[model samples]
Target: GAGVSQTPSNKVTEKGKYVELRCDPISGHTALYWYRQSLGQGPEFLIYFQGTGAADDSGLPNDRFFAVRPEGSVSTLKIQRTERGDSAVYLCASSSFGTGRVRNEQFFGPGTRLTVL
Candidate 1:
């Protein structure tokens, strides 16, 4: 079975530019998550979607970051006014419920590395 996938594996842009990163989760996954990882640091949770609506966006630093999963399958992360500090690997993961009400393991994509110069 196929896992999660992200497009434009690497992106290079200048400060103030806008960028959009896309993610395709595994089929039948009802929970999707977005995270950002910087050098020498663990991934920081950004936003999460239980379905079409964002369940938690508290991790978003400010007004510059946003994400959406309209169809509950594919998601897109939008960044505005990119800054050098925004350079990092954007990761996407998805999970679902398993038997006995347990939570399934979250499968992660390779991620899109964005470099802002």
Candidate 2:
């Protein structure tokens, strides 16, 4: 039973570069979510996927942010033209289902810390 995992626990980049963060969810989980947490703030939802389709992507801040979950397993968050304001910790979580009622607890992966300069 592999737990969720994220790559490049830390990242630092120039203000206009592109970056991609990866997440691997636990086996058998059907729902995956991406969120961003600024300093001293709670995680804000960015996108979610159920199976191979995005269920909710309303939280994505702008065109520079995008994510995909293909094969219903691993997912990647891509950011283009990164800005200084985009610096934050990107977190990924997964559960059996997206609904809170069906999946009470979300297993969180150690987040990727992104720093834009």
Candidate 3:
């Protein structure tokens, strides 16, 4: 894909249900990030992956939320026992941290809007 892509642009689920949001980063990017945005707020960092392993996961609210990037190209955000407060837009971004690259240049997906009813 030319840019980051996310699946099922919208998701509606009942409280306590499990939902998985998927992200496909641009090819060859070595870093990926997951963020959540609530109404009128900026995107909140959730997780950051460097290749196949997560480098930073401290931002995840609790054990109920998790993310994985097994092969390093694609990622998934899984929410267990979803709550009404979990209703927000989940965003995925990708960037390269190659040699001599001091900063990350992120390309973002359209995001998956999760509605916990």
For model 1, what is the alpha-carbon lDDT of residue 63? 97
- Model 1's alpha-carbon lDDT is 0.92
TM per candidate comes to 0.94, 0.94, 0.97
Q: Name the runs in model 1 displaced over 4 angstroms.
A: 100-104
**What is each predicted model's overall lDDT from 0 to 1?**
0.92, 0.93, 0.95
- For 3-85, candidate 2 gives per-residue lDDT tens digits of 99999899999999999999999998988999999999999999989898999999999999999988999999999999999
Which pairs clash in model 3?
none
Residues 61-110, model 1: lDDT tens digits: 99999998999999999999999999999999998765622645788999
Ranking of candidates on lDDT, top first:
3, 2, 1
Q: Distance from true position, residue 63, model 2, in Å?
A: 0.8
The stretch of ten residues in a row with the least summed lDDT in candidate 1 is 96-105
True-structure Cα RMSD, model 1: 1.5
* lDDT of predicted model 3: 0.95
